[model samples]
Target: MRHNRTQHRSRRGTRSITAASATVLAVVAATAAVQSNAFGTEEEPTAVSQSPTEAQAQDCGAGTFQAQVAKAGDTWKARHGDTVLYTGDDMFAAMNAGLDSLTPNRTTKERMVVLGSGTISASERLKLPSYTVLDVCGTINATGAVATDTGPIFSRDTTDVEVQHAKITGAPMYGMFFRSVSNLTLGQIDMRLSGGLGIRIDNGSKATPATNTRIDDVYVSGASSHAVETAGLDGVTIGTVTARDVGEAGLLLNTTTHAEVGTVDAQNVGTGTGYAAFRMANRNGRIGDGYENNIHVNQVIARGGGRGIFCVSESGGAVIDRVDIADTGNNAILVENCYNVTIAAEGGTVSGAGGIRIAARDEFANTSDVTLENLTVTDSFIKESPCAENTVIKNVELVNTTKDVC
Candidate 1:
């Protein structure tokens, strides 16, 4: 699948902030600015609440055109203008009630601001509809056993949906999940939990892939699966993916094309597995009927991970411009059964790692058009085994390193 399509911008507009909401808006704007800087993008960042104090102080319930769910002692209240939609202790119910009060079948976007932190059962999720924006200023702590393929936040087959300033904790099947969604934006999300995947987006069929997705400044810690994973996505833009002590890859892209990744910073991720800080599998970067350098990464910093970078399973057409990796358990960088792959195009360093390797499996075509240039390798090696074709290694500086090429 060639996903070399132009990214479409979201049609959401900014709302006027009152003096009372200035503090909350400032915090949200600051977080988005930091993410934009990290991604090296000039696009305006999405606004989100950063802390509990800010969430409480920002009484979004007072807005003329927005709905809100606020905690009042032991009970929660959902209101829109003069209408009181629901009042209960169940946060999930309160949120749904608030959402139900919005303009039905809205051609334009409507806002739902959830205030206060509370526990939502793992089996319960806040479902977002089209032309909807949900901003949770407080944390959502998930409890109980999750049903099959469930999460704290979910959206399916929706268009123009955005979630901001969401802080999710506790163990759920998935922190946040979206299926076949288009024009989606996730900004300033923080997931600190044990087990489950951090964020997952995918399409149900290969014919209809999710289009124009943007993820800005997501922090995932202690996830058993990938921090951010996308499948069958076209035109995806990621600002930064930060992972710490994660069980799998920091960012894993499968059957995705036309991806622009800003930075991946990972530490102690996928310590003993074949997963890498950044990995691409199952025709990740293929463009059109052939392959080109459609997948571009600005930088990657991996320390004490299972692997630094991996491109396998007939996936190729990627250029990782820079990398800084150290002491990885598996190959620091591995390109197997791929094509048109380039590593360290702008120069980088690999020290005390398992070294770089280029190989091919019998099940697929040999790895070809692979280039490794402008790199400094220390206490490592560079090997090209059972070799490929049109492989180039240039301007490489080695210290106590060996090369085995065939």
Candidate 2:
């Protein structure tokens, strides 16, 4: 169900952060750092010096690349083997020309590398074909308005595509958008945008739901919408979604199933609204007619935003292992009209937030098989209102707070 953004309630007054809250904050920061560094833990030996383009080419696996784009003076050049496909001022055009020059209907993957940093005044998106890898080793400054359905980079009806090391700055409709794609990988993307969404991956219809998608280490700031959003996706793995001052959820899963998420670290996201740091809606985690624990999250951290974790509109079957939430404007954790949900399976802490809530709307079935355990709540409360069935609340420590359960 779509939320009414116009009807926002007043936020609770800010509370002083205690020593306990500070400790939780530190833990959250450490968790984010650990996740960000997990893939780069191996030390690299010192090697011979190389030019920036040469080093970037090696990083992009350019030995297997069939096309290349490089900036020279005021112009960008696209080349394949000995053929110069394009030489122009538009970086986007040069990159696209490099892709278009590749041999079509190839059985194996074709790689392309953008060797250096440049700015593109693009009103259109750079599209990716199937069985392709586009490694952009340098920053891309995308400037100009785009159509509502397009973004800076997009792919549709594609299979086995990867984009690596993309650092973008713009207010496009989306930083990256992919639809009806299978076996897609987005690695180490950083977006600093002023408006629109950060990343969106979905199937245009349920008949062709995207499958086997992996997103590793994305950082988005100043976005007008969710940092990462997925709809109609199956078998997806998300490493981390880090958000700062985003207008909506840090990571939102809608009608998606078979998901594994590492961490969602958000700060000042969706203030004064019902959007959350992590949200599941539109029957997420559903398998067949029953709900399964298909959506698994390792950790979630939120500070000074709206909700911390939200499961609404018959979405559930998730196990959120840990959380560190503080000073949220709306409910710290809310499970509404959901099923088979468990929060803080390991342990967690919440402070100075609206606390945890379990509610149900009359239109849907009551939330069932829900558990909230192993949590320490400080300066907040936990309540199960109009209590549902088989709801479990155990091993909870309340400091300056109370629990009203039925």
Candidate 3:
């Protein structure tokens, strides 16, 4: 069905501030700016009393609108306040109408687009650009050949974006693709299945890396590629991510800086010939010059996969605190060409052909300051260290190890 597309634009004119009033206005403006930057719209507002200044700041602009799709109408009827904006069969048309009605004043006022629970089957990518908050609680399903052109939910060049309680299923490419975004938060993301990565965050060659990203409680199953892949991002934190039957690594970080993961559980990842449950890599087998650094994983549990955790090509400053592996196809943890790293399987058990292997492929490149501590290995073995002098082991119990430790 064909429909008319609507566009929303908030074009409130700005007024110049006088020098005499600038002092008083600056104080009030600073307080409002703090509220706007604190994920203010993402959370529910407080019920306590607010001062007049706070109230005015919170209501930054007037003429805000909200639209909801009709439940049983063939045409997607969207209404703003009490007026009907449009009635059309196109889901994007209705969504765009709602977004266009709001004036872009960057205020803490009520600016939103509430998606209907009905499944939206789009032939092309639905773009949400420059939206302060995108609370998608509905399902967006793709209906086309799998390609790298776009995704079910693609957002770019946005800031302070929040994606909450959303599901993107059966996308040809990435379920959700975000690029050049900052101060982003994603929670309760459910990607039932996707042809490519479940979620991908990258620079998209925009030269502006995505930064300050937070992902919580994400689950992906039957992903043809990595469940979550991030590259060229700074300051990312992930929590409670689980992937099942992924073709490549469940989570892959390439050229990322200052990343922290709370917990990740991958099952049957690395379905392809070369991959891992969790893979971290930098460029050119070097660090400290436009390379990835400062990655920490608190807990990792992998079952039946290629090396549970693989660090390659100058991935350094990494600290993995706890790891549990059972019958993985390859080494449970493999570190090649990495430095200043520490992996501790404290209070955990590893059962596989190879427990932990640290090697430097290039004879000239040396792996230094690597430590493995408090690990209990059973029916497995760690490879002889490539840099015997720099590898340190503490409180480790080995059973049936084929190679001797340094």
Candidate 4:
């Protein structure tokens, strides 16, 4: 008899679970191996030999849980050993069914591995279950005619989910919107021509913010809004992100803590009233609450449209090591009412016509305790307003211009 997921969920106890358990479950699920079989024919489902690429894809992670999935007709089927656990029209449904069929225990681990490469044309949002790995080697395209303003994958309260090697296109709102998800990992994901934000990670109305989130090797292009936006996130790490042709900011972080980004390359960002390629602000209005702290950006390269880097609040300190800006439509760096911030460009190039602009918008606005060091601007580096009290500049070099030192 097939298991009903709704009944299983209803039977789940309300026992308190530790946050550490989510991390352990995610690691276990991510390392599972999966072997592929061929399907999608009028004949009965039969096992075909796995190809070299299929075997290599399964080896991406390491674990003991083993499962197989195949495209059978218009539906997808998931199996563990010989038992067919779930069959559905979309990958999310098949994955949820496979997870529901698993025996609930502390020692048991589960994973769903995609077999064939095809597109899942989703008309509605796909919500993922907790403590499971959705390894999609294919693409998911949203084809809804009505703009419902939803992401392809929208998770409200899920935990420990890892989505990898997938491409999402044509989402009406955000390509992937994760809310209140703990221990989430998105690796090698691509979003193209998204009508709204490319990716957004936020914990809405949750007591604990989203923690231990990692996004690596992501490429978002042609987004109508920000390419990657995050808020109410803690212990987040992003690496090798490339956002291009975005209508708004390339990457925006609000009320985020303990963030360490490796490299970001943003090109041709901002359409109307957009801020910058990278923006850091205090959206929660929790000043000095220690919820927004310790943001470190290693490398940044921005070209064409919008400001280069914008610090829009007096909260959330940041340390930027290197920046390369060119063809910026506004100031290369705009610091307004920010504190405890340091922007240092060591051995970097800034060829844009606009330079760093630091000022206060109103009486309450101020920029202080900021340090600019070791920067080489190819054009004039102008100061929009009077230098803030305690502002420091060191080893600055300007070429092909007379204005320097703000």
Candidate 5:
């Protein structure tokens, strides 16, 4: 199957503005100029109330068009290939009603442009071929954004779209969901104050998943669970995706996926009783080959989360052979129920989140084949457990440094 690619553009044309009188016309014309800066919309920004003074629709370039707004309850829909650009502050005034009135039909090629502060309803399902882009010039404030039901930017099957610099917040469910969508690219995505998992790359099943995309400069916060999850996303390139103030692991990835995580900082991620910072499960086939699938490199900084970095059970073939963890709230690197996981230290303190009660230790996954190469110790762990069997402490160094574990 191929995606029907369509584009929307704006053109120049002149139309007469309705006038109450020449005097009233002058006033509205002035108002329209100010509105062009406010919401008259040279290009849609946010929604503005209907004006009795001016009764002329602004020109929406060629393929480009402005959504017709009703008093407050009225809705206008878009046909296939029609692109709606917004420039309003209220979500209700932005895209929902305009999108809801659209006649549902087969996937043809339509795109919804998110301008400023807008809200998308849970019941407002944007169907296929109808790609949505979160395009905001300055800041897309979703601080009060809300989705009542299973609110998501995507559902069912979505293919081909680009979302940039839009803050997605206040959803009863996942912020942006990729169900069975294939071949989509999400860049500069921000998930703030969401009730569900921030962003889900869930294929909904183990059989089929989302593939081919670059997720970069994405930040997620205030999720009940994992901030960024890739349950079934395959062949995807991820960069600078960080989750703060989360309830679970910052990033969760599983299956035959390839990813490069740069600087993962999860503060208050776990809810005092949860999983690892970076947890990759599902024993990828070809243990050794799949082991290659294990998170290759990462700079995980976790403080106040249940477990720092965890790999378990069937998530074999992948190895935590070498990771640099620092200032952890609990166990730095906890490996359990899996194989080929190793711990190599770097930096001043490793998963050593300056906490008094913190175990201040790195745990080796038990009941599985795992090893640590060139593990180091500082004056902090002098009073802790000793190294033996699968563990080795080499060239331990800790002096002028303040590692409380000792």
Candidate 6:
């Protein structure tokens, strides 16, 4: 194969390219391969087939241009195998288009790996092969654009896919999306600097948990929004979700199904510089639905936001346990309109405003069966305390003063 190089080219974001037409980019470090199948006009060619011009190689046939990239807007059709090394800006668009053009069938064996300094913006969505494992070991920048949600890595009706080891910055929308997907895994993925959350799941209302999907060793910083937002999902796992220096919440686990978080360290997030962490010891929509969903926050270190643990406008049942909120601007744990939610903060220090604001709503009439077990509130003063009615508390202390149920 021959090395190819070029400059500025774009078209929405989900265009395709032919194998014979794809440009083999020059590389500092990355490996690539190229191959294809053969068909015929009269009788079919054997194992291999030659393009009208030739293959994507240095030495073409008798009279043909070598494996140079076709002109801009040119596409390769039905090309399967590829080894592409991308460099320079706009590689995001280039690579996305190339992968889309491949258009493999529903077979779960297609694979893609991109390695380079990829920087770009987009106005469209890109689709990858089903049962595809697209590995990106490089850098990507797509910040500053409103979420056209214009996707570069999207897999619908796909399963068992994995994306790992990449620096993805400035997502116009979701860093990665899985719709109707199963057993998907995003490993060692880093999304930081500008735009929205590092990752998000549609488990609460819109989409399912993309079942058996686990995001591990993911670190996000400087988010225009949450470092990671998981909503309306079930059976999802976040290994080490860490976010700091962000806007909005650090990690928003709202209206979810079955979720298990390892270590969540969110600081300096929300509005501008606040630490509104999570609330409700349990953040799940319950066995009440007969699904028996479960959620747990193993270890949390939150600083400087509104409420450190917040579960507002959530229904169903959940359990939250063992959270630590220190030096926060607002409440340490607050739950509003939560039903059958049990919160446990035994080994924690809540030294901030509104330590635990679990209410039935703005009034006492709209209450649920909520419980705060083994919680400790130190240096806490009411940021509008006197937590409404019909709430149960055991082995808990409300220190530094407030109005009680009197």
Q: What is the C-alpha lDDT of each candidate?
A: 0.79, 0.78, 0.63, 0.64, 0.47, 0.51
In model 3, which regions exceed 4 Å deviation?
1-70, 73-75, 105-123, 206-208, 283-293
The order by descending TM-score is: 1, 2, 4, 3, 6, 5
- How many residue pairs in model 6 have overlapping backbones? 32
Error of 3 at 216 (Å): 1.5
Best by lDDT: 1
Model 3: per-residue Cα lDDT over 279-331, one tens digit each? 88763212344222256677888999676888887666666789888878878
> What lDDT tens digits, residue by residue, belong to model 1 across residues 1-406?
2223222211110111122123334544556544432312112223464332233223322222367787767788888866899988899999899888878888777877777778999888788898777777667888888887788989999988877557889888889999999978776788998888899999967586898787766899989989999999977778789998899999999998777777899999999999999999998877655566667787989999799999999888788889999999999999998888888999999988499999988988778888898999999999998798778899999999999987
Better of 1 and 5 by TM-score: 1
Q: Assess candidate 6 and give its lDDT.
A: 0.51
RMSD of each: 7.9, 9.8, 12.8, 10.9, 15.1, 15.7
Clashes of each: 1, 0, 3, 2, 32, 32
Q: Rank by lDDT, highest first.
A: 1, 2, 4, 3, 6, 5
Q: How does model 5 score by TM-score?
A: 0.62
- Evaluated against the true structure, the overall lDDT of model 4 is 0.64
**Best of the two (1, 4) by TM-score:** 1
Instruction: Quote the lDDT for 103 in model 1.
Output: 83
Estimate, for each residue in 198-229, the C-alpha lDDT of model 6 and write its tens digit: 56555333444446556655678876766776
**Count of backbone collisions within predicted model 4:** 2
lDDT of 5 by residue, 1-406 (tens): 1111111110100011111122323433443343333222224333345331122222111123233332223332222235543333445444454555444552433334433344555444333233433333222223334454244455556665444334666643666666666655554566786567777776776576566544655688888877877766655555555778788778777664444444566777774654666766664312233233324433566666666676654453333323444555555655544444444434324435332111112342232334444444332232222222233334445443343321
Instruction: State every prediction's TM-score relative to the real structure.
Output: 0.85, 0.85, 0.77, 0.77, 0.62, 0.68
